[model samples]
Target: MAVTRIAAAAAHFGRDLDHDLGRIGKLISDARAEGAALLVLPDAAIGGYLADLRHPDPEALPPALKPDDPIFEHIGALAGDMVVCVGFCEAEGNDRYNAAVCLTGAGVLGRHRKVHLPAAEGIVYRAGDSFAAFDTPVGRIGMLIDYDKTFPESARTLALDGAQVVACLSAWPASITNAAPKMSQDRQSRLFDLYDCARAAENQIVVVSSNQTGAAGGMRFLGQAKVVGPAGNVLARTWAKAGLAVAELDVAGEIAAARRVLRHLDELRPESYRVSR
Candidate 1:
């Protein structure tokens, strides 16, 4: 089976919920109309993740921002035959979480909260505990949000759980001002290359990443998104533009990539590497 996937950055940040969600909805519709079976939108597609800090109290967040928010029904209705993976803020119980939602034509498949958060975001959102993968019609997909991608152990755990595709939804910012020059572009690009190659080669799984674009507050987004095969090679990539790129994943391509590297997942000796936790 060939899995058709599309990815794009939610480059622009709107002033309010209604404006941002409307743009997100239109982006989804456009991707679906372009014949993408799965669409990956940038992190916090609905509401600006950290751009606006005056977040509603956990209990006061509108239903749409809540995990069980009925707006999922509207998203489900619009899903058509495509599956969607989007980043958002979710409310579960009394705690607010930075989360990514996975929705398919069959309804919501799962929600993965961000386990690792930056110091700046830690004040507003609680960190998550579990790391798991979800099964979709396409295959088993794993999710990691933003900063999580930098940690090898994070994606390694997902690979151990049988994730065929490991993806990240991030609001990546450009370099800060310096007396010499800015290096944020180089930094983010290098990070992307490291995570993409490490996760793909170490686990023999496809890696996809979507990053935010445009400027929010004082930060400027880099806006480069890409799909990489198991061999750590670029299959399809989107430039700085806020557009979508589609790629087809075939069993042959995936298998060849893995076999070409000849993975050693079965030869690990976890017994000797045990840690006291």
Candidate 2:
């Protein structure tokens, strides 16, 4: 079994494209120096997230870039041999999406446009329609953005599609309506960690979670980046601070061990489960 080092980041980023790129480059360099084969960055790491999640100002929306924009070219060049997953506002013709791309210097390995829209997000971005797992140097991987992790089906779909590791990127903020006394105690903070562990354990897959740190616009972000094992054990984490959570594990071996007894994906009774249309 080969051990792969993976890193998840909790860092602050904003709308300035050039500055954001430089920050991302530095994060990549640091992750590479730490021997991380894959680095997962926060959502909206390129152009920043919405100023307010509950009541967004249309004029303050993130700047959108094409999927194959030069900014990604720059990021790809900086990535070199390491696999990096970063979120950005995607511009496809006239429509915009809140999307994340898994890439290496070679090019994009896979891309996920966020499927679940929460609160005011749908006001600015179009929702994605499907979940898929794709191959990378690290292993079979999938991606989900922010609120997407709140839904069980999102990660389950990826696991069914053969994803061994799922990277969840977020610009998740503290409770917008009910602010906590401390960032750590925020409702969103608890939910973020909860969903991370639940998704990893339930799907029997490794979960790499990253989020925006500090404050952007009027929103205060909760930075609890973490790496959760298949047993719902948090191997590494960063709480309410800007940092990188790193872990080294034998991806294939760990998953095999986790599923030696109960294969959650194989024992599902989908027909018995019903959802109202």
Query: What does the lDDT read for residue 210 in candidate 1?
Result: 83
The per-model lDDT (C-alpha) reads: 0.72, 0.94
| Model 1 TM-score on a 0 to 1 scale | 0.86
Model 2 worst lDDT run, 10 consecutive residues: 176-185
Put down candidate 2 lDDT per residue, 110-158, tens digits, no spaces: 9999999999789889999999999999999999999999999999999
Best by TM-score: 2
- Residue 185's lDDT in candidate 1: 38
Off by over 4 Å in 1: 1-3, 8-10, 52-64, 177-185, 251-253, 272-277
Candidate 1: lDDT of 117?
Answer: 79
Question: In each prediction, how many residue pairs overlap at the backbone (N, C-alpha, C within less than 3 A)?
Answer: 2, 0
Residue 30 miss distance in model 1 (angstroms): 2.5
Cα lDDT tens digits for candidate 1, 101-197: 8896568887789998775567678898988998877678888888888888888888888887777787777654321144433666566657766
